[model samples]
Target: MDRRKFLSATGLGAVALGAASTSVGAAPKTAAPAAKGGPAKFKLGCQSAPFDDEHFAFFARYGVRNCSSSAKILDPGRIYPTVDELKTLTDMGDRHGVSVDMVDSVLLTSSHIDREKNPAIMLAQDPQRDRDIEAFQTLIRNCAAAGIPAVKYNMSILGVLRSGKVKGRGDSEYLAWNLAEAKPPTPLTRAGVVDADRFWERITYFLDRVAPVAKEYKVKIACHPQDPGVPPSGYQGVDRVLGTIDGLKKFITINENPYHGLNFCQGTVSEDLRDPGTEIFDVIRYFGNRKKIFNVHFRNIKGHRDNFAEVFPDEGDVNFLEAIKVYKEVGYDGMLMPDHVPEVPGKPEARLENFAFAYGYIRGLIQAADHLA
Candidate 1:
C-alpha cells in the first residue's frame, strides 16, 4: 500500500490514476472480456455484527452496499431463522440501501469450541449431530427462501487462537499470536485429542450432510479456515486439518458442490505461509479462478507463519493494493470486508473509526484496481 504513495511521488500513480478514471468513466460497451464470474464487481461490505439500525445506518453513511449480517433473527436463542424474521433483516437493510448478502449464526462462528452451537456437528456425534445438521439444512433452505445468497460459518474445535496483544501506532493494540509464547492446556478443548484424520472425518461428516442441501437451495456455504495454523506435531493435542491451503483445496472437493466454498480470511491464510507478501496472490488466484471464493475477510498481518500481528491493511506484510489487483484478476464478485481491526484508544468509537478507515481504503482500492486493467 505504501508503494502506491511512492508510485504517486514518481508520477506512475498519476498515470495509472488517470487511466483508471478514464476507463471507469468510459461506456460499459467498451469493457473487455471477464473471467467466469464475469467482469469483476467488487462491492465494499462489512460484518455489521449487530445488524441493528445503528450499524445499518453506519453502513449507509459509508455507502456500503452488501454485508455479512449477524442480525437478531440469527441470534443464539433461535435454532433456525424464520423466513419472516430474515425478511425483517432485509427490510432493515433495505431502509439503509444495503443488501444482506450473508449471515452467520447457523453454524455459529469461530468462537470457542466448547461454546459452539452445533458441537455434535464438529464432534462427529450422531443422533445429536443429525438434529444439528437438519437445523443447518433448514437454515440453508431459509436463506434461499429469504434470498440471502450465502451463509458464512466456522468448523473448528479450537476457534481463533492468540498469544496476546501488543500496543502500536498511536496506542492501538494489535491482536497477535506467537506459538513460542503459547502454553496450550494439556486437556486441550472438550473435543479432546482430535488428530488430522479424526478432524477430517468430522469435517466430512458435516459436509456430506449439508452440501447437497446448500446445492438444492442455491445457497452458498462459506466455511472459514482455521486462524494461524501451528506445527503439525499438534497444538494442545489437536490437529487443525483446515489450517493449510492444501487442506482447503481438499475441502472444496469433498462434496464438490458449486455452493460449497470459502469465506477466505486472507490474514489467517497468510499466517500459514512462510512469506505472505510473496505467496498470497498465488493463493488468491487459485481460489478465485476456480470460483471457490464466495466471500473474503480482507485484513492483513505483520508477520508470517506461527508468529504475526493482525495489523491495518496499509502496514501489513502483504501489499493489499497488489492483492486487490489479483482479486480483480480472478474476477471475484463478492464482499471484501475488514475482519480484524486493531484496538485503538477511542473506546467503541475507535473501533468504528478503524472500520471507517478500512472500508474507505478498500473501496478506493477496488475502484483503482477496476480501472487499472
Candidate 2:
C-alpha cells in the first residue's frame, strides 16, 4: 500500500506526532499520542516488568520499549518519591532503551486484603484510610511532576484465585480455575463475609476520596478486576464486586473522573465470562470506546469461566488477532502486555523465555493489524 493509503486505511492519517520527556534532565522527546485529537497509538508494553540492570538487559535484548515498572526507586512507603527520584527511574530505563511510563502502587496492588498495608482504604476504616489515600495522592503528584503519565493499582480484596494447573501445548502448565475443584485454605479471609452492598460501599468510599486527586494530577489510576468471578453466595466468605462484568461496568462510573479506570486484564476478564471468545469484543468496545482502559494485560485463556486454563497468546479461545484489531478499532492507546503466562519448562531462562514469546507475539500481531486490509 502507498503511504497515504496506508495511513488512511490504518486510521493513522490524523495522528498528531506528540512527544513527552520520558527520562531525567531534559531527556530526548519520545513520540506518542497527542494530549488531544491525535490518533491513539497502541504501544506494546509489559506490566510488573523488571527494573534492575540484568532484567533491563533482558527486555532491551528483545526490543521492549514502554512498560509499567515494579521498581522501588520512587517508593510510596518510604517517602513520596521526589520528582528527581522519579526521574532517576526513567533515566535508568533510558540507559536500556525502555521507558518507565507507569509504576505500581506501593501500598495497594494485588495483595490479599488481609495482607495489605493500605487495608483501611478498602476496609472502610475512617481516618487511617484517609491517611493511606493521602500517600497515594502524594505519589500521584510526584508522578505528574516527573512527567510520568499513569499509576497502575488494584483494589482487590481476594487477590487472584486458581484451582489447579493443566498441561497445555508443548507440555506447558496453564493456570487453571475450575470452581468445582476450587479449594481455599479456609472458608473466609480476615475481611470476611462482605456482601455486594458492602463491597460497593467500600469501593465508592475509596473512589470518592482518590478520584479527585487523580484528576487534579492528570495521572491515570488503573484498577485491575478480581481474578475469577465468584458466585453471588460469595467465595472465601467474601464478595468481590469487581469480579463480574456488571460490577466492572458500575465501577468506572462512581467518581467518573478521567484518571480512574481499569488496568484491563484481558486474561482475568476472559475468566469472568462463560464464552470469552464471543463475549470479549463488546466488553473491549464498551470500555475502550469510553476511553477508560489505561493499560491492557494482553494474555489469553483456553476455556470459559469456572472451567479454564491460562494459555499463550496464539493458542487460546479468543482470537487475539481479532482482539488486537478491536483494540485498534476502539483507539486503545496504551500498552498491551502479557500479565499471566503458562509455565512451559526446560528453557535456561524459563520464565523470561516465556515472557519473550509473548512480547514477540504481541509485536507480530501489531504488525499484522497495522497492514491488514
Candidate 3:
C-alpha cells in the first residue's frame, strides 16, 4: 500500500476516539497522562515487519509508543533508502508521533553464519568482515542520527520457524515450537562443518566489534536466548548460544556490561514448561534495575516444545498480570513489543491489525493496573 492511502485507511481513528475525546460521567474524571522522571511510562509496540510505512504510521497515530525493527525493513539492500530517504523516515516519525525505540540487527543465528560465509553478509567486515561491521554500524548510525536510544540484537542459532505441518492447521489451534531436528543436510560452505564453538566465536567477535559502536551511539545490545532450550545437534550443523538458562547466564558472564543486556521473551522462556512469572520476574529482578534489560517481546504461549500454540495474552498459561506487576515493580521502562498474534479473520492487512489489537490490549492492561495501584 502507498503511504498516504495506507495511513488514512488505518490511522489514528482506532484509539483516538478515547485519546481525543473527554469522558462524560458522574465526576467527569480524566485519565492521567503518562508520567515522566521517576520512570518512563512503559508502552506497547510491535516489530516493523509485514512491512509498510503507513502500517507503522497507523500504529503511531493510534498510540503505539515504540517499535522493534526487522532486518527486512532496515538493511541497506532492502529499502535501500539513501541518506535523504532516511531523513524522510525521521521526518515521518516526527509527523506521526513515533520514535524508533529499538533498532534490530540481523539474527545472530542464521544471519550471522550467512555473513561469515558470504562476503555480501559481511556487514563491515574488512576483507572478510565489513569496513566497520557495516550493517550494525549502519543501524546504530541511523538510530543515533534519528535520535533513537537503543538497538536490540539476537544471538540464537535459529530464530523463529514453525513447520508447515503446524501452520497448515489453519483453523485448528497449534503452538509454534522448535524441532530437535538437525539442519543442513549437506555442507553449504568450504568449511567442513560449522560447529557451535565457531558460531560462538563469530558471535563474540561480532559483539566485540559492534558493542563499542553501540556504546558510542548509546544503544543497548539485547541478546535473546535460543528458543526451545535445545542445543544444536551434530547432524544439524546449526549451533545455538543461549539455548538454556545457564547458557544465558554464561553469555552474560562472558560479556559483562550495562550496555550488553537481555531481551526477555516470555513465550520462549515458557516453552521450557516453566512458569512465565518466575522466568520473567527473575530476569527483571536481576537485570531490570541495572538497566540491563534493553526491551521485551511479550506474548502468551501454551504447552511445551512440539506442542505450543500462540494464544491471546490473557488466554495462555503465562501470568501476564503478574508479569506486568513485576515490570512496574522493577521499573522496566523499556519498550514492550508484542511478539506474536494469531491472524485476525477478514483482516487482509495482517501486520497493522495484529499490532493494533496488541497495542490496545496491552494499553488497557497497563492502564487498568495503574488505576488500581
Question: What is the clash count for each candidate, in the order shown?
Answer: 0, 0, 14
Ranking by lDDT: 1, 2, 3
TM-score of 2: 0.86
Q: What is the lDDT of residue 308 in candidate 3?
A: 51
Residue 187, model 1: Cα distance from true site in angstroms: 3.5
Cα deviation at 358, candidate 2, in Å, is 0.6
Model 3 TM-score (2 dp):
0.72
The candidate maximizing TM-score is 1
Tell me model 3's lDDT, rounded to 2 decimals.
0.55
Tens-place lDDT per residue, model 3, 79-99, is: 223344455555555666766
Sorted by TM-score, highest first, which candidate order results?
1, 2, 3
Report residue 165 deviation for candidate 2 (angstroms): 1.1
For residues 22-129, could you state the per-residue lDDT of candidate 2 as single tens digits? Answer: 111222222212123334378788864557777777777776789888546444447346678788788888899988878876767788776776687777788887
Which pairs clash (backbone N, Cα, C closer than 3 Å) in model 1?
none
Indicate which candidate wins on lDDT. 1
Q: Give the whole-model CA lDDT for all candidates, comma-separated.
A: 0.79, 0.76, 0.55
Q: In angstroms, how far off is 60's CA in candidate 3? A: 3.2
Q: Please, what is the TM-score per model?
A: 0.88, 0.86, 0.72
